[model samples]
Target: MEPTTLRAVMAALRKPETGCPWDLKQDHQSLARYLREEAAEVLEALAALRPGDPATEAHLCEELGDLWLQVAFHAQLAADRGAWDIHDVERAIVQKLVRRHPHVFAEVDVEGADEVLTNWAAIKREEKGQAADHEPRLLDGIPASLSPMDEALEIGRRCAKVGFEWPDLEGVLDKVKEEVGELQAESDPVRVEEEFGDVLFSLMQWARKKGVDPDAALRRQMIRFKGRFASVEDDARAAGGWEQRDLDQMEEAWQAAKRKGKA
Candidate 1:
């Protein structure tokens, strides 16, 4: 009687005769939301982590395990259908890593991280049967699951690699201003939406050129806003309720919080 491992536990949970009803009923499509949710929880846990804090470390570990469960569950479902299993998934990634990292696994020499990345892309293209002489598709290798901001950043990077980009940060900033002007001038709802998207895309390019991660910047801003807003909420509660507070009072509270270094 050995202790059951994660794979074995997943298999038991999906067993037809004795498995939990909810576990037995799940399929890949139905489990997709959980996969996304678990990944988001892992990100939140990572954001909450503090140096030398065991509680935060434990929280991150738990969230990561929840994310891993989604992978194991999917593998179990595939195994039940006689397609593949967890080991197949693990082995495929291991093989791909070794195949891609020629600098470590083979005799290929790279001077720096940039050269390593360039070599990795070349190797990846070769593996995908993209011939060296063939004109590569602009967005062929970008993952479809990337967020729109991330996708825009990748698109900008790919285009820049082939000398199809603004020459300087000022050029990108000018493009951003142009896009904003177009967005502000649009009146029709459909056209406004399109123009707004263009503005966001241009801003993403600007962020890329500025060496800023838009997602991380947004997350940090939101965290600051949350803390400031919590101060406003406390003020509202002290004054009776939200109904008793006005926008100016809320602004004062927010400014106080900002002065207190919440921002």
Candidate 2:
């Protein structure tokens, strides 16, 4: 049978006997890495977007579709096991959104975005069966699957909500410096690794305090570095390849690329 819809297509691909062999071999755990990869590609496509560039827009659209396929694939896997399917996934999100947004769906009043967020958190806790007077654990709801940097930022944000954070930007800056100092003083490899993690976590908190998305900042920096390094590689190729060019020559090329603002 010809699959007409996205969900139908996924179901067709996962169908036994006539289905794709590779698709039949995959499970939720096996598809996890592809999900992460598709999401990262979507982010990259978003970063490459320009105001009126149709090519970049198309690229973003394609990447988003790829990410959506991961969702559909997982939903198909669940369906194969006699669990919920794609429509259930869609309905669940719709129900959750309507339930969470009382300010829009109900008569609840909110002053601003912040108040809306506050109300949303309260509603989420209530939905989780947490009492209004209950003091939840510090990192109760934070997902363990989050990247370390994101986990650090969440930890800082959660603590800040309960008045545990530093008073000002200066205090965060001092903490960053202190963590860096501790990292620098570490000699043992294990201790060094631990201190380095502390420094990174401290920097993540600092970035949160400064209203910066650390992941986006790091991605942009990596893009810029790649651009500059490409120039250095070009210079090396022009001078008879990498074997002929020294670190100083590469550094000069990198500096020139930086001066030209390659990214």
Candidate 3:
């Protein structure tokens, strides 16, 4: 649909006399979470889109509608505040899209997708005034509120950009090993804690260098661990009881459950 028509539709939805009460009541802060949820739903639907999957299409439509709802709701809020209406929002984004894509809209030369990426990066760097060496710059861009694992990845990427990175995956592996050795040698509680954290951080850095999302990778492992441990608990309860088993016995059972996950 056209931007003008979409704005009209949103205006109707937030009309004081006959609009959606829920939408009218929402603010930016209130609708912030819905954006994330709808984005995840969109991603989920896309992931499940395959041959002969009617449900996936249905899910995709619903997710898109949810996302649209957030956009309209926010536009309404902005209109109410007299800051900018939905038209301004649409116009701003349209302008930004044309401005960013010089390759398509302008006579700018490009070789391939790589050239486009270089142009895009150069545009962004020019906008942000990024340094030539990229020294301590990406770190400056990463939000302080980002999750710890995500911060590790961001910091690792920043360092990698400056060439303070492992030469290869083997070096990362060695770094992890070194941290582990330090962890084992430390006896002071504080020192041990720091060493163990160093190991985890090194592992996260290694994952980044290997093109792995350490957070998602660890979350996958955590899900598997939870599933297997729950199974062990169930097995122990059915056999006799977990309380009846000693620490070593329970540990053995847990290990067996982990092996079952590998199968």
Candidate 4:
């Protein structure tokens, strides 16, 4: 469907007297989870897409439509509240992109992507009123809503940009080890929790330095675990029941599953 058609459809659903009762009742807070779900579905669709596949392209297009619907829904909600509309959202992003990309839109020169990113960050700081500060925070604007692993990655990247990172990958690994040792030595639960978080944070930084996405890595591991565990359960069901299996038996089943390339 065309963009204008979709916007009209959403507007009809949001009509006061003749609209969907559920859609009419939804506020931004209530619709928040749908937005997150749609975004994740888009990611899943992209990850499942194979290069040069027309079917994958259709799947991605459908997923993107769902994601875009969330944006339109939010825009409608804001418009109903007299805050802003879809056009305002579109206009703001257009203005922000043109303002931020001096090298592309204006006379500024940049050598490569790194320089472009540096200039972009500087422009962002200026826009946020932090450029003139003497002692600006490294982790400013890192969203609290992000998962701990992602937040750690963002914090590490921000700090690294300001030369506050470890001397080498080995130094980061050593910090992880040191954090683990402190965690082992701690007897207090609160201190142990803090130290445990430090260990994960250090490992997250190490992963970032090594050009790995910690969130995606962990997600893949979890998927592997699911496959391997399902194989183990299949074996147990074939024998008798999972409750009848000892730890050694389960380990054997797990190893057999791994050997079968389930993981």
Best-performing candidate as measured by lDDT: 2
| Model 1 clashing residue pairs (backbone) | none
Runs with alpha carbons beyond 4 Å of true place in candidate 4: 1-4, 40-63, 129-131, 134-136
Which ten contiguous residues of candidate 2 have the minimum total lDDT?
42-51
lDDT of model 2 at position 118: 81
Select the stronger candidate by lDDT from 2 and 4: 2
Higher-scoring candidate on lDDT, 2 or 3: 2
Q: What is the lDDT of every predicted structure here?
A: 0.89, 0.90, 0.79, 0.86
Candidate 2 clashes between residue pairs 3 or more apart in a chain or in different chains: none
**lDDT for each residue of candidate 2 in 116-209, tens digit (9 for 90 to 100):** 8788888888898988788478788789888888889999988887789999999999998999999899899999999988888889988999
Best by TM-score: 2
Model 3, stretches more than 4 Å misplaced? 1-25, 30-72, 85-118, 128-138, 247-263
Q: Best to worst by TM-score, what's the order?
A: 2, 1, 4, 3
How many clashes does the backbone of model 1 have? 0
Candidate 1 lDDT over 97-125, as tens digits, reads: 99989889999888988787788888888
